[model samples]
Target chain A: MDWNCTLTEERLSDYLEGSLLPGEAAAFSAHASGCVQCTQLVAQVKMLVSRMQQAPPVEEPRHLAGRILDATLGPREREHSGSGMFAWLPSIWQPRFAMGLVTVAASILIIFHASATAGGKTALNPVNMFRAANRQVHLAYAHGAKFVNGLRVVYEIQSRLTSQPETMSEPISEPARAPNAEPRPGQPAQPPASEQRQKSQSIPHSGRRHTHGASELAALSIISREDLTNGAIRSIL
Target chain B: MRRHTRRVYNLCYRFTGNAASSEDLSQEVFLRIYRTLPSYRPEQGAFPTWLTSVTRNLLVDHYRRTRRDRLTDSIEDAMPQLEEKHSPARTPDRLAQASELSAQLQRGLARLSPELREAVILRDLQGLDYAEVQKVLQVPEGTVKSRINRGRIELARVLEEMGLRPA
Candidate 1:
């Protein structure tokens, strides 16, 4: 192969890229080793190609992407603003803001409904509103107190009923004791057998009466022992 | 979008050697792409190659359109503007050397003819392979290689003339 300066110049990139035929590459290298202009050209071009390949790309303008988008997509909706005193009015359309507005409106509606019902007539007057609010507060307090007293009475009945079994479980003295017994001065005299039987039967009735009185005070109704037990079991479950 | 924009912008900046014009040309290229997006067939080429082709066509049209203006306005006047835009003081410390070399290379690229400049940029700076460059240039592979070869030599000479020895 007749390798020359022209061949070297034409095949310069191929030689640099190592894509030339082995024979051609050998010939090209042989020619360039002896030729001063070819050697210098090869060195310089090789260095230039390497540096260019390694060169960092020029930084584009930061806003070029935004500008292109605006140009392509027609200048995005400008974030919904108005040139008026109520500039923030458009912000109310946001989902979060709208949700908050709905909650506030519902709360106001509830307040008005309660006031109208409590006052016996709907009026926007401040005095009427205040009076209705006061009445509502007093009614709520009364209901709360009533509820607390009912719970207290139910618990008290449950405790007394539970304690009655323990009292009855204690050992009862023998009923066959002598009819006539000597009385000691310091000790209280035992009641007669018939009296003792009457007293024992009267004890549970007295407890029932006490429970009835408490239930009347708390709930304005009578609650039997069985009902109180059922209520307590239901509360526990 | 960001990747495509950077590619287009880099091509424009390399070809035109002006940041403002590159930005405008990049937007224009994307706008053209947007309008003609339907016409783009994936079977024809990869999207990046198509994008590069669109950018190259626009650059060629831009070069032709601004030939008269470029002739009237001194290139020396434009060089300072580019330098001021990419001043070393403004660039971060790590990028200062690369930036300087890039600026110097830009000046050298400006001296080459449009065909040679585009060839060198696509092959070397843009890192397009010969086949891809051929596709983007819409030329035969032989012409792409020849042009890249000549462009590299011419650029080296130009850079040497400018006292910049590539490391």
Candidate 2:
């Protein structure tokens, strides 16, 4: 067998383990039949495997298995046994389990604290304090008096649009004249200057109306965003 | 539970050369297995495969945690060929020779890089197939085969140095 490059390590390992696919196995067998290098590698691998198999396992101590089993399966058996016996126990009698739970909780808390300490992140470190303060400042900026003022402006605009519907009507047909001025004899009739000024002021009213769902939502969102914003959330809490 | 525990204990003892540490680690392994039972998915692989992986992981962790406590310390003195009553297939002289050879084999194994050691142990000692080892190692099958071959070559060399031929 001309094994030189044809006998790859993968094929050899697979062949040794009998895990190669049929085609690859057939190919390998064909190569091994004629390939000296491949046959020698196989022989060497076999010798190594035989020696390993012959090596006796280390002695296990008595009751080691029992301990392992106990560790593995003890909890389930305890759960089953305890549940049956402790089912009738009053909530007052639950203190033992509660105490055990508390101890575990305390240990976990200690572990967390110790880990933090080891990482140089003690709970009361100045960095944590600084971060807390910075967070608080951000929250205040997002949901403070300034935000409320903006919401109030929006609410006022909404009220004006809703209460003054006529503010959205079409413009007057004639040009403006001075306040309280009557139309000239030859001139087209026109609104008095005062009415024209009022109309001009109210023209903007229609634009402020919350006609679309998004706009309505915009009105509600002032409060909601404030609630979600860090400052607002902190305030609410 | 007792029978299962015994089987696992024996398995661990076979893997770890030290009896005491193996006993302790075996218990710890089982405890972890029990705690993680809720997350075990048999569909992921065979139960034994998963179990072997778990056991292997525990042993590695134990080795790491107690790096100072190696079998090499008492190996020369302790590598007597004998089997305890439980695993009674072993005869005294063959057992003693096998134990010494096992020690040499373990030393050879210990000398290997952990990755190579893992591949060799999975393939040879635990008798896992290449595909199963690939799954266990989360590596391509080609890489697994190379590691195994390289690992075996190194082991044979080490064995030769220790005056034990591969055969």
Scored by lDDT, model 2 comes in at: 0.62
Residue B22 in candidate 2, Cα distance off native in Å: 1.0
Best by lDDT: 1
Candidate 2: where are CA atoms >4 Å away? A1-11, A15-42, A53-59, A72-237, B1-7, B10-15, B68-101
lDDT of 1 by residue, B1-167 (tens): 98899899999988887767888899999999999999999999999999999999999999999888878877554464455456443345424534777877888898899999999999898889998999999889999988999999998898887788887
C-alpha RMSD between model 2 and the true structure? 25.6
TM-score of chain A of 1: 0.43
Task: List ranges where model 1 is wrong by over 4 Å.
Answer: A77-94, A97-237, B75-98
TM-score of chain B in each prediction: 0.88, 0.72
Docking category for candidate 1?
Answer: medium
Deviation of model 1 at B97, angstroms: 9.1
Report clash pairs, candidate 1: none
DockQ of each: 0.57, 0.26
Q: Candidate 1 overall Cα lDDT vs. reference? A: 0.81
